[model samples]
Structures are given as structure tokens and as C-alpha cells.
Target: MNPAPKSWWGTPRTITETIDNRKISWLELFSDLIYVVIIHTFVENLTEHFNLFGFITFWVLFLFFFNTWTNMVLYFDLHGQNNLRNLFFALLQVVAIAITATFTGEAFAGHYTGFIWAYSFNQLIYMYLYWQTMRNDPLHATTTRPFLIAYVVGEALLIGSIWLPSLPLQQALIIISLLIFVSTVMSEHRNFDREFKQRQIPFELNSAILERYGLFTMIVLGESLAGIIEHMTAEHTHLADYTHFGLALLCIIGTWMIYYTLMDERKIEADRYWPISFFRGIHRFLIACLTLQSFFIGQTLGTGQLVYYRGLSLVTAASLLALLALTRLPRFNVQPLATWPTRWLVLGIIAILILQFAPVFVGLLLMDLILLGIGILNWTKNV
Candidate 1:
């Protein structure tokens, strides 16, 4: 006799399977609004000084804000019942994220212990919700258990480290944060191992996750663009400097064009054959590149730092754009020398380097031309 079909609540679901049910939901996209505020707050903090302690604190707080929201979204996307209660919970989480952003500076200043408390509390609640979801419908218990433990331990160390009240203790907090990051990463590996062994994740679900990550990348890019516009409006009384304004616009457009031409939609769709773990690793790097680039842009605009006119900013942007291109290239098995696109990218970098010592206007002009050239080339090639 054939085995009876399992009930919906009885059969365990893989992470990928869960995501496929609701790919790119409105709720997920809308939830990222809070992060816009958080990024702004980070920029404000960085503008004050390049202090070591302040930078470290900014990184930790930024990561915490990002990771907490990401984990929550991942959990709900996988396990939420799509009911009113869960919806409310998600909304509450957004509010919590905004609150955390508001107090980030104070927390760094060691004045707002309440913000720390609130952050830790929200994390605990998030973890508890995940545990409840697992209890109700346990799937990949080995992966989930380790992940939860890591989450708990990380939060504990984070909260505990805050109370040390000494510089040594503060330094130790940074170390503990690194450990937390390691544990979180290991948990992902554990999840992948279990998924591979069980053969539960599907191609669609993997695509969903990657696409979600890409949307976050868009958020960072948009934030950077907004910062530039805001700075120009507030600082430059003469909006008549159409040349400088046009170059800035070209730079932004070029960055977007180069990145999207290489990967954007294609990368997400290619998740079926690619190892999800490897894809995630590549994504982390991509996000880092985008974040750093955004930071550079914000620093440039906010401070009038002219780093880009010199070669440093241009090289930095080129290196990141090149890395983004290379990630896409690997999947096609295209060797660097054999690829004209890569050659052009390298030439662009070299030009950027040489232009560093030139007049700022000259450097800007060259960058605009290079980006426009790349954009035109990619368009012609139908990339």
C-alpha cells in the first residue's frame, strides 16, 4: 500500500520552501524604511570625528541594527503564519528598529543604557518567536538549535559587555562582537549542511532570498544618492553649477549601470545551480562593497572631502565596481585576460589612478567619460 500523504502541519518545511510561498512580499520591502533612518544616523556619527572607539561603536551598532532586522525578516518569511498577530509583531519590530537608530549615538556615548536594554529586549523577543515557531513545527532542528544558541550567547555577551564601565571592558566588547559574528556565520553553515543532506531547499526559495538581499543593496544605494542630493541642496547656494551637478549624476548612474549590467537580475536567477552557501558569501561581500562605497560617497558629500577628485576615492569606487563585476564573471567561467569587459574595467581603474593628481574638474570629467563609456559598452553588448 502507498504511504498516506502527510498533513500540512506535520511535514517539515525547509527554509527555501518557506520562502517560495511568499517571494518578495510588500511587507518585506516596506520594512526596510527603518534602515534608511539608521544609515543617516551612522553618517551623522561618522561626521563628528574619525575616532577609533567611535568607528568601532558605529560598526557594532550598524551591524546589530542590520542583523537584527534581517534575522527577523528571515524568520517571518520562513515561519510566519501570515496572520494579523504575526503582522503586528513584524510592525513592532520595525518600530523597535527605529528606536534603536534614534539612540545609537547615545548608546555609543555610554549615556543611554536604556537603548541597549531595549535592543537586547527586542532581540530576545525575536529569538523567542523563532523558538515558538520551531516548537510548533520543527524543521531542521539541528540547524535551528545551534542558530538560536548562538543568537542567545551573542546577545548575552553584547549586553554584558556594555556594563564593564572601563576602556578594557569596552575593548573586550569589540572582541566579543567578533566572536558573535563567527558563531552566527557557523550557524549558517550548519543550516546549509542540513539542507544539503535533507535535500529540502528548492531553487525558487533560494532565488527569493538572494533577491531580498539585492533589494537591501538598492536601499543602501538609494540612501547614498539621497545624501548627495541633500548635501548639494544645503551647501551649494548656486544650483547653476550644472557641470559639477551633471558629473555627479553621471557618477551615480555609472555605478548603478556597471553593477546591474554584471549581475543584478541574472545573479539571483542563477541560484539554482550555485551553492546557496557560496552565493550567500558572495552577497556578504557585495553588500560590504556597496556599504563602503555608500560611506565614501556620504563622506565626500557631507564634508566636501574631494577624496574622489584625488585618486583615492576613484580607485576605491573602481575596485569595488571591479569586484562586483568579477563575482558575475566567475559563474560564466570567463578568464580575466580573455574578457574585454574586465580589461575595460582595469583600464578605467588605471585612468582613475592617473587622474588623481590632475585638477578635480579633470578627474571628474574623466570619471564621467569612463562610466558613460562602460555603460554604453554594456548596453551594446546586451549585458
Candidate 2:
């Protein structure tokens, strides 16, 4: 696309866009920094209530957050003009994230009016940005309009839900809103193949998109890394505390190995066979699991909450399984999980889950061992 309009507050010229450069710009990094704050807030909320309903709420809010973020990323990938207008909108996104984070608690408590308005406002800007670009690229804009409609109606319900005195009614409204959001994703993706085939709108993935995805995944895991660093440096002077902290750090390293092993560039063919929705879904789940693990570790190390140790094992094992699914190894180049090492790892995760229900420390020890086994498998594979 030609540079965003030479004037302030104008759309970019998409007609001339080509696949020449694919590096993450400084501005994109700045924007992603803002996104980390949002993700952190979500994690804190999820761990604040470690129950089934809390998990459900986390997933619901996550889908909305993911949708808003994906649209913005796609827009910039396609039509970013990199002018004051784009920067200004990016700043607006930061504010929107802050508002959502601020009202996260109330939203979960059924006082969602402010949160809905904030979310709706964010979606509105996304639509406007597309509208600006759509003047030059109607086909792409048309493909995204369904999502725009869904956001509008969903926000409207969110606003109305505020007046609902009955808790169940408010919950119903939110549920319906979530369903609308789901439909938007499904509808747009369902038509994407047809739209791309018929319209020939120069849609293709470059290495940078994959790089961005990987970078985002790293950012999420960085939270885990940060927690580990903090715990190690804290004043846990007793021998047992020191030992547990060391084991926790090892598990964090193990989590890193699981990702770098299966998701290395050797395994992921970003150019082909990667469906965006699936890719995003797996990454979201991966982030969720890691976030849970980090929270559990922090709680254990901070308050000596040994009870959360089993929960930590569960999410760490869950993350391993989810990452394996994401690697698509069985269907793609690598051999299936039936491989000896991989099979034992799966069995190991199951064993941890069942055994954790035994004496808590027993489960925690086994979890750490399983992680160490994974790291060893990769590190010594050639040896």
C-alpha cells in the first residue's frame, strides 16, 4: 500500500502493497509492550479465583481480547501507514487496554457496563481504521465487516446487561455476547478461503508474521521467567525453601525447552498449512497454561502455599500437551507422539496428574522430574 495518506488521519494505500519487507518495527514492539500489561491483568484475575467458573470467565474474556488484538495486528500487517494517525490509534489502544484492566474485577462481578463500553469503543476504532483502508481495498474490508457487526451488537448487549438486576439475566446477556463474538470469528474464517480464492487480494504470510507470533509467545513465557527470577532473589533463606525455589526455576527452564524444541523453525512451515485460527487458538491456550503455572509458582514461593503445587503440575503438564498438539508433528514432518520418548512424556504428565492427588510433595517432586526428563531428552538427543 502506498504510504498511509500523506495527510494526517488518512488510510494507507493497499493497492501497491508487496511482500518485500517483514521485520518487526519499533512501534510494533511498543504496542506489544502495552499488550503485556493487559495479559498480566487477565492472568492475575484468573488465578485470583482458582475454580471452574473462574476458568470459564478467563476463556470468555480471552477470546474477546484475542479478537481485538488479532484485528489490529492484521490491519497493521496489511494497511499500516505508520503515520501520526496510526500512532495515535495505537495510543488509543493502550488506553483501551488500561480501561479494561481497571474494570476487570467489576466485569467479573457482573458490573460490566464500563468494561463493555470500553471494549465496544476499542472495536469501533478497529472498524474505523478498516473503513479508512477499505476505501481502497473493498474486498478485504467486506470480509471483515461481519466481525464489525458482531462487535457492535455484542457491545449493545453488554450495555443492556448492566440494567439487568437479576444475576442470571446479566450472565445470559454476556453468554450471548460471547456467542456473537464466536460467530464473527467463524463467519469471517469460513468465508476467508472463498474470498481469497475469488478476490485474489494479495493475502499471504511472510516470515515476520511467524516471527511476531513467536515473539508474542516468548513475551507470555517471559512472565514465567520473571516470576522465577523474583522468587530466586527473594529472602527464602531456609534450605527447603532454597531447594523448592531451585526446582521451580528448573521447571521454568523445562517449559522453555518444550517450546523451543517442538516449535523451532525446523518444524513450523509458516508459509503453508498453518491455519490462522488454529494457530491463534493454540497460542492462547499455551499462554493460559503458562500464566496459570506462573501464578501457582508465585503463590507457593511467596506464602508457602504448598497446596497450589499440584495445580502447578497440572498446568505445566497441560501446557506440554497443548504445545505438542500445536506442533502438528504427527500430521506434519515429525513422527507422531507414539515415538518412545514422546510416549513416556505423555504418560509422565498423566502420572503426575493422578499421583499429585497423593501426598502433595510427592506430586510436586514427580512434576519436576518429568520436566527435567523433557529438558534432558532434547539436550542429550544427539549425545
lDDT measured at residue 195 in model 2 versus the true structure, 0 to 100: 64
In model 1, what is the error at residue 154, expressed in angstroms? 1.2
Q: Could you give candidate 1's per-residue lDDT for residues 52-115 as a string of tens digits?
A: 7766676666666666756765675565554555666678888777776778778567554666
Task: In model 1, state the lDDT of residue 299.
Answer: 58
Candidate 2 C-alpha lDDT tens digits along 134-240: 66677766566666667778878877887888978987898898778655764576566566556555334455665666677777777766776676687667898
**Candidate 1 off by > 4 Å:** 1-22, 51-54, 107-112, 187-191, 202-205, 238-240, 268-275, 298-326, 329-338, 353-355
Highest lDDT scorer? 2
Q: Give lDDT per model, in order.
A: 0.61, 0.68
Candidate 2 runs further than 4 Å off:
1-10, 13-16, 46-48, 199-205, 228-235, 266-274, 303-307, 329-345, 379-383
Per model, state how many residue pairs clash. Answer: 0, 2
